[model samples]
Target: MSDEDIAPGSDVEQEVLDDEPKSILLGIIGQLRKGGDLSRVTLPTFVLEPRSMTERITDFMSHPELINNAPLNTDPVGRFADVVAYFLSGWHIKPKGVKKPYNPVLGEFFRCRWDFEDGSTAYYVCEQVSHHPPVSVYFYANPQNDIWISGHVRPASKFLGNSAATLMRGTHHVQFKRSWPGEEYTVTLPNVYARGILFGSMYLELGDSVVLKCPKNDLVADIDFQTKGFFTGVYNGVKGRIKRESSGEVIYNIAGKWTDSIQFTKASTSEKKTVFNAATAQIHTKVPPAEDAQEEFEARKLWERVTKGITTKNLDYATKEKTAIEDNQRVILKERAAKGVTWQPRFFTGPVDDDWSFGLKE
Candidate 1:
């Protein structure tokens, strides 16, 4: 191939430069498109309703391990509700006065407190009404002084639609040490949802940031996580909280109900580190830690080639000029080459241009 075809500034180079960015952007979109595969993945649609003790007992048989040492195992829903009732029973809230509906699938419970006196209540104050459920539940306090208790059960669909996913934004910082081993590393980040309740099965967005310093350089990085699952409503709901813009209400929010931290670190490996030149950049001789033999060898070879070429070119140019002065004029011509070589020819003569002054007052 010609030099035009193979060199850095060639047409091929320009074409590659133009297409590289588009190719990378398309590659990223391809990975995000994998979310479409969720169509084949089955997800349970929760139907929340009240159930009796007998029904809770039937459901317990299906998952016996869930209620091995617990009290009340009459029906599926009732058994689960009874378990919840036990936890709440410790509180002074009357069960009948509570009149709240619970959903097992979403792991949530709702109840109304007619009046809670801090004098008798150990957990909360008299003015504060408690509404904590199993996994994800919202409770609002009533300001009116004690007598009537009332609340409603509504689909979480309104609160948990597109808005829930958007409200789930976060950032974290992590440091990497060079002495750290392993190509794959895990940094236990503080749970992003530091203040939300675990609602039923919901989608969560997990993100991370890593800051690294090497020599004099530093950098930042990010990663994304997503998935779905049942919020046990127990300890492991990935709990957190955020303020609601629409209703101006603050509730215990759930960050991640379904997914765990599996594929959390999905970022390019190169961004995790920074590289800089080491001091004592190049060596001339090797004694011990002071100098490197390989660098010395490479430097010596480079200088030898460069000086040798300069000497050889000067000798060749002199020979050419000597032959050119044969018989035409017996003149010594001093000319400069296009490559910046200052050529001075020595002829069978004495002082060339000092004798003839071009009308200049020296």
Candidate 2:
């Protein structure tokens, strides 16, 4: 690829000349056309998000106040209705794009916290527990509210024609405080389907089905994420209903785009209330700067060079640093294996299933 191929005098050329990594994107597209495996492929660093996967998954906990306000509803069904709203709040956190986040190296970790509007705090920690299957374990908690989120998910990526799809296979548990801490809500992640590979206009969606349920309460929230068809279907159409476990008595119907607001209509009175409105919602997107971050554990510090490369539009530097970091990890793993040593996750050491109710009291 050359400047001539970049279409002179257009935004493409201007963007490319301003940032060279914008140029290697053509190469990435070419590789994708040949059905190159994204997991094993070396992605151009310019398209990097400049953050670790650990940090990225914290998008779920960005709206901690929603969880803190769960008790306000008073009724079990109403509270779960609010919980479903809280779950949908963070669906559209990142915009649709072909750009992908760097696969986390083994033992990579991220920790951060958010200061909410009501003066409450939500802290989070994530660990890259496995590399081959690409598993990430995350924990988020607001001690003041006694709410916590814990889960481990292994993401599998594949090339599906014009899109790169990733399936999230793991369930996260949500525990809220009250006299009834015994009942925990279990939530599973939805599949991520991102399109617009061949064309320039790209979009992202959470596809397939996702459910939120409490075993003790026997209440289930069935959510179906509607992905847009080739030309039809809504982009972010999310529709579901909260129903009983035994009789399957539908309590409330949920409908709305995950990026916008989700409404809960009580089955008895048809009373509708918008529990989550993203337009007015406050989202936290700050992280520790590289200088202030610890030497290696922090994402900003670990990928500082790669970030600099992309920010400065130095593709060569970005690729070099990214490769060096990846290579160093490989060598370390090899040496450890030769020495008959095993690597363990710092934050998540036991079975991930334990995380579902890890800190919750029985």
The best candidate in terms of TM-score: 2
- Runs of candidate 1 with Cα error greater than 4 angstroms are 1-163, 166-216, 227-362
Lowest lDDT 10-residue stretch of candidate 2: 10-19
Candidate 2's TM-score = 0.85
How high is each candidate's TM-score? Answer: 0.14, 0.85
lDDT of 1 by residue, 238-321 (tens): 332222334433222223221221111113231221111112111111111122332321222212332233345443443343
Per-prediction count of colliding residue pairs?
Answer: 25, 0
lDDT per residue for candidate 2 within 1-362, as digits (tens), equals 22243333322111221234434555565667444456766776655666678778877876766678775556787668767877888866773344567788988877777776677777787778788978888888777776777888878877776677888888688877563578689898889865654444455667898999988878999999987664565657788999998899999888887877778888999999887887888887545445765757566678878878877878689889999999999899999999999987777666744453233223
Task: Write down the lDDT of every candidate, Cα atoms only.
Answer: 0.21, 0.73
The clash tally of candidate 1 reads 25
Tell me, by lDDT, which candidate is best. 2
